[model samples]
Target: MSEKPVVRSSILPIPKSIGLVWLNIALALILAAIGLGVGFAQSGLAAQQVILYTVLMAATVFVLLNYVAVVFEARAEARAVASEEDQEAESSRLRQLWADNRVLAIAMATLLVLYLILTAAIPEFRSIKNLIGFLVLELILLFAFKISGYFAAGRSAFIGLIVLFALIVISAFSIEGFLSGPNIKAILLFAAFLGIASVGQTMVALLGGLDLSIPFVIGSSNIALLFLITLGVPSYVAFGFILVLGGIVGFLNGVMSYRLQGQALIVTLGTGFAVAGFTQIMTSIGSQFAGNVFGTVPGWLSNLAAMNGRFFGIPFPPTIFIWLAIAVILIVGLKTTTWGRNLYALGGNRRSARLIGISEFKYWVGCYVISGVFAALAGSLLLGWSGGAFIGVGDPYLFTTLAAVVIGGTSLLGGNGGYGFTVIGVLVLQVLTSFLLGIGLEYEWQQFIFGLLILPMVALYGRSPHIRATV
Candidate 1:
C-alpha cells in the first residue's frame, strides 16, 4: 500500500498594520478630547461655544476616518500579500507604491483639509500672513520627514512633526505677550549663535567623540576680545583677532584628539580646564592693563552691558551678523563638500571606512577643528552681544550645545545627521527657554523644565533598532 502523503504547515503571524493604525487614531482622539475639555473649561466665549465644540468634533471625526481609511487599505494589501502563493511580486509592488508617494499624499491631504477648516472656523487663524506662515512651516516639516525617511520608517516622526507644529502655533500667538521687538531679536540672535556652535559639537558627537572644551574655548576667546576692545582696538581689528583665536583653539583640540587616540570626552575635558584657567589669567591681566591706563578707555564699553542694538528695523544687535555668517558657512561646508561625506563615513563605521582608504585621523581632526571654530565663533558672538564679554561668557553653552545637538536628532553614537536638524534642535531648545522666561519662571526652574522637555526627545532619537542589533 502507498504511504499517505504528509503535509506540513508553518505558522507566521500577520503584520499588525491595522492594529498600529487604530492605536494611532485612538491616541489622537484621546488627545483631541482632552484638548476640547480644556478649551471648554477655559474659554469665556459663551456665544461661540457651540461653534467651537462643533468644529472640534468635526476635526476629530475627520482625522479618525482618514487614518482608518489609510490603515484599512494598507492592511488589505498586507493580507493579499500574505495569502499569495508567490508573495514576493505582490509585496514588492505594494511596497514600491507605498514608498513612492501614497503615504505622503495622504498626509498632505489631511493637513490641507485641517488647515482649511481651522482657517474657516477660527477667525484668528485666517489672517493671510499667519496662514502663509503655517503653510510654509508645514511644507518644511513635510520635506524634512521625506528626506529623513521618517515618514516611511514609522509613525513616531509623523507624530513628532504634528506635535511640533502645534507647539509652534501656540508659541507664535503666546509669544506676542512676552516678547518685545528687542527681546525677540535677542532671542533670535542667541538661538542663531547656539545653532552655529552646536553644529561643530554635533559633528564631533556624530564621530563618537564629545568636546567638553567648547565652552571654555568660547569663554576665553570672548574675554580676550573684550580685553582688546577695552584697549581701544578698532571693532574690525578686534573681530578679526577673535576669529583667529577661535580657529587656533579649535585646531589645538583637533590635534590633541588625533594624537591621544582615546576617550574624546576626557581629552576635551582636560583641555577645557586648561583653557578655563587661561581665561581667568587673561581676565586678570586685562583688568590690570585697564587700571594702569588710568581710565583712557571709553567708559561706554563698560556701561553698555546689553547688546541691544537695531538693524534695519529688526533690532538684531551686533551679534546677529556673526551668528548668521557662522550658520551660512557651516551649512555650505557640511552639505556640499567632500570632507563632510568622509566625516560621515568615518563616524558611521570606522573599520569599513579604513578598508575603503578613508583617512580616519584626518577626518577626526577635521571634526574637532570645526567644533573649535564654532566654539570660538560662539564666544565672539557672545562678547559682541553683551557689548563686552565677561570671564564666564561661555559657561552656559557647554551643556546647552550638547543638549541641542542631541535633541536635534544627531546620533551621539556617530554618523546619521545634518545641520538642518541641528538648526531645528537649537530653535526648539531656545523656544523652550524663551517660553519659560515668558512665564516668569526662575532660572533654576527654567533649567529644570528645559531638561525635562529635552531628555525625552534625546532618548527617543538615540535609541535605534539597528544599533541595538549591533550591540
Candidate 2:
C-alpha cells in the first residue's frame, strides 16, 4: 500500500501572553467605567464609596479570572503540542510577572482615582482624620489580603498568627473608649458566632453534600434552648442538652441519608422542614411557660443571657466562648482525625473509598453527626446572643452559612475544601453585608446583592469542570 503523508492542522492559533494582558486591561477599563457611571448616577458620598468598592471588587475579579484563564489556556496548549517545555516556560514567565505586578498596579491606580473623587466630593475628606481613616482602611485590606493569600497558598499554621496580628493592629488603631468596650466585644463575639456557623455548612459541603436542613436544625436547637432557659434550666445545662439534641438530629440525618440512598439535598430539605415545624412548636411553648418559671431560673443564668458580662477585664458574651470552642474543635477534628480523612476520601470518590476498605455509610453518618453538633452549637450561641430565641432565628443562617462556605472556596461538589476557607468566607460575607447596610440598601436588596456575590464563587469553585471533561 502507498503511504500518505501526515499533515498537521493549525487553524486556530493559541493566544499570546501579550494578548491576554491587553484583554485584562480592557476588562479593567470597562469595569472602571461602569463603576464610575453608576456612582455618577447615584450622586453623593454614598456613590463615591460604592464606586470605590465596585472598582476594587471588579479589579480583584479581573485579576483572578485572568490568572485562571492563563493557567488553563497554557495547559490546553501544552496538551496539543508535541513538546510543551518551551510553552510552559513562556507561560510561567508571563504568570510570574503578572502575579508580581498586575494586582498591585491596579490597586494603586484605583486608590489614586478614589482619593481624587473623595477629595472632590467631600472637602472634609482632605482632613487628617480622613487621611488617617483611609490609611487604616488600607492597612486592614493589606493585612486581610496578605493573610488570605498566605494561607491560600498552603501555609496553614501561619493563619492563626496572621489573624492575631491583624486583630491586635485593629484594636491598637481603635478610638479607645469611643464605643463602650462591652458593645465592641459583643460585635466581635457575634462575628465569631456567624463565622463558626458558616464553617459547619462548609464542612458538609466539602463532603459533597448540601445540608438544606442546617437552618431548621439551628432554629429548632435555638428554640429548644430558649424553652429550657424559660423553664428555669441553668445556662450550662441547657447548653449541654442542646448539644446532645443536635448530635441526635445529625445521627438521624445520617441514618436517613444512608438508608434511603437519596440525594443529600432532598434528604436535608425534608429534615429542615420537620425541624422548623418543631422549632415553631417549641417557641410557642417557651413563650407560654416563661412566667411560670421566672422564679426558678437562676440569677447566673439571667446574667449570662444579657451578653454584656465582663470576662477577664475584657467584656464578652458567653456566645464568644461557644464560638471559640466550636472553632477549635471543628478545625482540629477536620484536620487531624481519621474520620475527617474518610469524609474527604468519600467526597472525592465514594467508589474508590469503598475499594480501600473505607465504610462509606459510617463516614457519611459521622459527617452528619458533626454537622448536627456544630449547627446545635450555632443555635445555642444565637439564643445567648439574642437574649432568647425568636422565630426564624436559624432561617438567615441557612443561606448565609452556605454562602460563606462556598465563598471561602470550598467546593460545592464534594471534596477539595476546608475550615479555613469557611472562616474567611464567613468574614467576607459578613463584611459585605455590613457594607451593604451601611450604604442603606433595603433588606431585600441586601439579600439580592449577597445572592449575586455568592453565585459567582459557587459557580467558579463548586463545580468541577476538569472532572466533567475527564468523564
Q: Who wins the TM-score comparison?
A: 1
Which pairs clash inside model 2?
Answer: 208-414
User: What are the per-residue Cα lDDT tens digits for candidate 2 across 76-112?
Assistant: 6555663466657667998998776554445545555
How well does candidate 2 match the true structure, expressed as C-alpha RMSD? 11.5
Clashes of 1: 1
What lDDT does each candidate get? 0.64, 0.63
CA deviation > 4 Å runs, candidate 2: 1-187, 232-234, 282-307, 456-471
Candidate 2 has a TM-score of: 0.60
Error of 2 at 444 (Å): 2.3
Candidate 2 local Cα displacement, residue 249, angstroms: 1.3
